[model samples]
Target: MAEMLYQRDVYGKALVELGKKNKDIVVFDADLSGSTRTSFFAKEFPERFFNFGVAEQNMMAAATGLASCGKTVFVSTFAIFAAGRAWDQVRNSVAYSGYNVKIVATHAGISVGPDGASHQALEDIALMQAIPKMNIIVPCDGPQTREAVIACIDIKGAFYIRLGRPKVPTVENKGKFEFGKAQVITKGDDVTIIACGIMVNEALAAAENLAKNGIKVRVINVHTIRPLDNDTILKAACETRGIVICEEHTVIGGLASSVQEVVAENNPVKVLCLGIKNRFGQSGSPSELLKEYNLTSFDIEEAVKKVIS
Candidate 1:
């Protein structure tokens, strides 16, 4: 873990970078241009930017139309509305058609803080996971967010990127970003910690703490969830005695479920998870919410120990 940065802040700038490269790149926002940072693209290319004034469904439908005409459409809005409110269009029009639309949703998970449960999107991943032809990317920090932004442009199909509002510790991952590949941050034999988004940093911290106790913990950053890097995941499950899956979303249908399904069918290792346990988020500071939901490094450290035991 290193400097703190917001993935959405990096995403806003990355859109401008992509716009300058491709003339057919269009951006759509649900009146959250400033918050979601599609305003960066809005500023650079106002002619290509469209604001739907709070209608996420309309924005998604219009984006689908643009994509059908061979335009690479990038849509932005809060995570809740981007995945929940406009899901019909996202599923029926965008995903069902298999267009080149990228839904870069910000303010995801319970870390939106004082926004309360109404704004928090604990089920965004699950909702998108239910849809077909939708690639999901949960970048750990700003650099990876930029990497994902550039990589998704060539990927033919719809993509849902989940980004949070608050600044999170940067988890350093070696090598260039590859789509649908997992980065093993550390090598361990006792246990493996598979995580995404801000949880990557927590996994790293937990690995460091466990090291002092003479435990070898391998940490994996699975940025792309849709086409999950099953080879790396299965390798980790085979090399380690146990595995711990971590994410900021719900445990039911999110990262944990995905890893468990693969492991159960393949190697079948003892697994533990750190995430929301079937409940809504409440208004609180980001740090408080993380601890309240048992998503801190300390919680991960404990889980690793318990898994090993």
Candidate 2:
């Protein structure tokens, strides 16, 4: 099969489509508009675009104000700044007030590459998932990122959509996925690989490679980090003897963390968590960083065999 195109253009294209449909839709950026692809919306609707410089807190407050007034506001920035810089505004103004503002944060995880630990957002998912009334989403690829942006407008509450700096493989088609719904990319009985964000592609590739060695693997897309699809995870875990979770985020409080939460309460099974193992990122390309952090497809395949062995 031919490989699908991978680029951040999916997000840019989705913003353009949404901007054309809804007049209440607005975008706010914290000096990283070009990087986050919110600049695409700004291009068409310059009147509705607001650049908040580097003041992420003010941008958060402004987005909350827009949401309160019935406007679907999208706040864009790097994941590090979105969570680390404006976390107070997000928790107090957005989550505490229960605003409908969408936090479309990008450049998440070790995939950030080149920027190092200061810019990489390894712990963002854990921090945001702990907040009350916050909807957490980690889209697998660009197409899913576009879907995530469109879905954030309909969901009424504080939302965090984690995006990456790298262009990931498009394993899913538009409108074929949804929020709080897990996508089972592949099915098997030996082990289930529940993943989200960029790791979805990695898990799928790992599954294909594992099949050559006679290991059966199931791949699932756990897109919604908060309000996680517990039923799908539990079902997959119960059917498969073991589970392997893959993500571009830290293993502490991301897809793997959510999977563990469900498996611990419902089913007892052997689980292998694949991600950054409690370490900060360094400057390099996305692929280099993933390999350095042991988040490559080979690593995932090896992890599955280890758990089964």
Candidate 3:
């Protein structure tokens, strides 16, 4: 069998379908409607769509206002703006008010390709996860992203959906979905690699590579960041003697930080984090950026080998 390459179009189609059935599910964008692909919803439901130019702060406030009117408003923008620029509005309005607002921030991490550091959102998960009443989700691929959009529609309070620009492979094909839960893709007793978003694919690939060397590695997708899946994480840590945390985002406050907190209190294991260090990425293609920032499958393989050794 061959590996699959996912597309973002599937998520757009799912959003269109959800908009047809749920009138309360409104869409908002910050000028980059085409880039984020929320324009599909805008075309289908013009009456329920609002574009706030490049004003991400205004868009966040407006989404909160719309949510106040009993609407499930989904505000879409580049992750950099949705979480970084509009952090104040998101924290005060949507999070503090516990509004039914969904924030879909695309182009997360170094996967934004040639756009480089300015467009890449390396701290979105950490930034949004810090807010109270915020549900943070980082779907692995297009199909999962679609499921995430549907799940966010009725999820209570405020939520953040982190998306990447690069097409990511769908790790799960079971056609099931849930919020605030981690998906354990594979089982192993040697080591566990907990990752999310685009890094999920890399982690799985690394696990396969490690298997050839007689180092069985388990892979878990911690898609939901805010409500850290403590149960699954601790279970994996206890089962696997050592652990490796991976993500496209910065290591400071991303998946590594989340897993570290859980392991500190519950299960202690030799842990390694694979992500961009305290450095900015230069302009390059997505693949090039991954290599430059050490966010590739090879990097994960090397990290696993090092941890085991």
Candidate 4:
């Protein structure tokens, strides 16, 4: 595995670099800058950093106001607070108006660990996906997260960039990021595994394990959830024997649902979604929670086998 780096730190550092180049860039955090690593931007651009002190809704609204006034606003908070608690503001104040506000939410999924179910945002993607004109990006690793942050600056309208708390393995550093494109990490014909966020690393490990057993699998990193790579997904479905989706989020409206929608409409194929099945998270270590929720590489391998069977 490559050297582990926290996604939040990468995003924070990237924001600092962006700020140095663009005077219009401003950052807002809901009293969790330290945890979300937005403090890096705050430290360098103190005048542009606005700490909202736990008021996520107000922070989102304020972000909209700043964006309206020609500021490239980046808002940071826990995923739960950003997507759940501030949904109204995000929808009405940002997405509805097509504002250039980037919502970089950290601590998403069960990886939030000891913070428990309340903090873990298993349904954040679903919530954000439901809103019109809401662009969603779930970076797979540190490098991808940094690239995504930079990409968001150029993308117009409201954007939601989901990030994790733990130091996940850096999976993709060589590939260039496109807003609606999926990267084919490995090519195969027997099965295709579509994954995003930290689960992309797990999917890669699962593919390696399956290869040992003579099961060829294709691994695709679907970092962009909304405006999904429909062409790539359809091509994988048509070429591969079956498809599997692995995510650290709920199966309802995440990458699994997005891929299934594409396959069903274009070319029907068997799909096994490996993720939290209509359940909430709990307090535990990151590893312990992942094991308990069956989100490890072994689980992804099993799902692939099931889909191919």
Steric collisions counted per model = 0, 1, 0, 0
Taking the tens digit of each residue's C-alpha lDDT, what string does model 2 give over 1-309? 424433356776787899999998889998888888888999999999999998999999888888899888888899999998889999999899887888888888898889799999998998898898799998887677777888888889889988887766678432377788888888788899888887887888899999988888888988898888888898997899899888887888777888998899889899999888878889999888889988888999998998898
Ten residues in a row with the worst lDDT in model 1?
A: 168-177
Colliding pairs, model 2: 114-284
What lDDT is obtained when candidate 4 is compared to the true structure? 0.92
For model 3, the superposed segments whose C-alpha errors exceed 4 Å read 1-7, 172-175
Model 2 residue 185 distance off true place after TM-score fit, in angstroms: 0.8
**What's the distance in Å from true for residue 220, model 2?**
0.6
In model 1, the Cα lDDT at residue 91 comes to 98
**Candidate 2, residue 128: CA error in Å?**
0.7
Query: What is the TM-score (0 to 1) of candidate 1?
Result: 0.98
List runs of model 2 lying over 4 Å from the truth: 1-7, 172-175
User: How large is the C-alpha RMSD of every model relative to the true structure?
Assistant: 0.9, 1.6, 1.5, 0.9
Best candidate, lDDT-wise? 1
Model 4 C-alpha RMSD vs. true structure (Å) is 0.9
> Is candidate 3 or 4 superior in lDDT?
4
Error of model 1, residue 267, in angstroms: 1.1
Superposed by TM-score, candidate 1 places the C-alpha of residue 173 at a distance from the truth, in angstroms, of 3.8
